[model samples]
Target chain A: MLRKMRRRITIRIDMTPMVDVIILLLIFFFMTSTFREAEAIDVQLPHAYAGVRIPKTGVYHILISEDGKIYADNEPMQSREEFIQAIVSSRATNPNLIFDVKADQDVEYGVMLTVMEDLRRAGIVRFNLSIFKEAGAW
Target chain B: MAGANVGGGEGRSRTGRRRISIHIDMTPMVDVIILLLIFFFMTSQFKEPHGIEITLPKTDVPVKIPESNTVTLRVDENNEVYFNEEPVEEISKIREYLIARQTENPNLVTILDVHPSAKYKTMVDVLDEFKIAADETGVTKFSLAMKREETAPEGGGG
Candidate 1:
């Protein structure tokens, strides 16, 4: 009993497994993660169940606020002419740029369509409309 | 293990030959790695962006569809949905109407004509329902009609 009392119990935990897992996760995130640019305007995107995953790279954002304000790639435009000019300049640098439009749900359909008409006039045939995912049966 | 022993003289083996045990202090490295991991986890957008693909016509010319073969849906400013000039009680009924109409006429084309003052969400909701109906009937022909005269910008001025 004296010998048993003299010996002290020591507790040790091996952190190798945890460190290994963390390193693996770090590498995974490093490979797959892409940083998103800060948005100039806030928009409450509409929810739809038919939304498909859009490509993250080579995307130019077109944001439309609730008050009919338009932002091209976080740059506020004074008018539709300025918006078109911005698109034209951006297209010069990146020919493969795909516009991804994010309009607030409260925005008027007229404003949105007028923007689309301008895009059409600018020779842009295809674009993506950003939306949130709604929970539903796929 | 705390520090690395680079040819330390204090370590000696039983054979009288000099020996050393090298160890690396992993605490600092681990701390940095953990910090990076947390930063990435917080900054990355967890949800992938979802969107709908749209293709517009190249010219200002409009394509005409037969009146009898077309079903025009009108959504007013108050979120009121009208099906072929008839008011619909609920938006959900659109799916049923489309499915029934498509079954009746295989060549039927849908046209969405939303009022300028209508909310954008109403159009999206209607499009979603149209997609559902299209999925059921395997027909995807649809058109978006908008008024361009009153709001048209004639001058160079914005």
Candidate 2:
């Protein structure tokens, strides 16, 4: 009697389903992910009903805290001269640059006015005062 | 785990009876995907903040401001609010006054004369009131001005 011995078998996996699921997940993430501009400091904005949506591009941010500290693009500056220099340099690159002044509600009006004066002396004419919109104020 | 052994060596011929089966565990993959989904969801900011435009008055250039169609709202250093030369007893009165003024002149412009020493909160509150009034009465234009040099009245009305 002759006996037949079975050869060792190799198993294979079809990766089509796994690849399909992974690709679907990749597409979902790509669709849902949002790329937002970086904010250096947080501010407690005043609420108003006449607030408008400011343009996202071509804007410079000047943040003022309650204690009269000034920050340009999140970097604290020593004097108005520093602010003027920064604005001049930034304005050279983008002529249409508009300043977005965000001042805390508790800050004295004089501090804000002085900042605005410095910006104006730097030749920045167009700017927005950042404010949060009050709900149901339309 | 229940479907792990469904297709284990069932299609083998009699000669190849000893067969091996392959299984891919998807629990770890699903866990990773869910973690990534949560991470993306947590870091994303969906809404943009709002703002109101303010043009600073030029020190060198003097422009004539028309007084005919303008309503002046002043906030003194003591935080007393005056609407169109009249003292406002309550903040809500600003809305009512603006509505009445809007009926008389549709193209009215509001000028805010804020004192330098005035509290920023008071100015903001007044601005908020103006905004509410504008929204209710359909007045679109407004401006901020520095209060002219004048002496405060005796015994300050707070």
lDDT at B4, model 2: 46
Candidate 1 C-alpha lDDT tens digits along A1-106: 8997886876556667888998999998888887755898779999887777888889999999999899999989898888888998888899999988899999
* lDDT score at residue A36, model 2, on the 0-100 scale: 62
What C-alpha lDDT values do all the predictions have?
A: 0.81, 0.72
**Distance from true location, Cα of B61 in model 2, Å:** 3.9
DockQ of 1: 0.69
* Local accuracy of candidate 2 as per-residue lDDT tens digits, A1-138: 233466556765665587577758666766965656666666777767667787777678889888888989888989989988988898899888878888887788888778867887897656778887777734
lDDT string for model 1 (B65-145, tens) is: 568888888898888999998999988889999999998998887888788899999998888888778888887777777
Q: What is the lDDT of residue B28 in candidate 1?
A: 83
TM-score of chain A for each candidate? Answer: 0.81, 0.72
lDDT of 2 by residue, B1-158 (tens): 44544666544443455455666776677677667766766776555667766555445544454578878888888888998778988866787788788778977777777887887767777877777776676775666664355321111000
Best by lDDT: 1
- In candidate 2, the residue pairs with backbone N, CA or C atoms under 3 Å apart (3 or more residues apart, or in different chains) clash, namely none
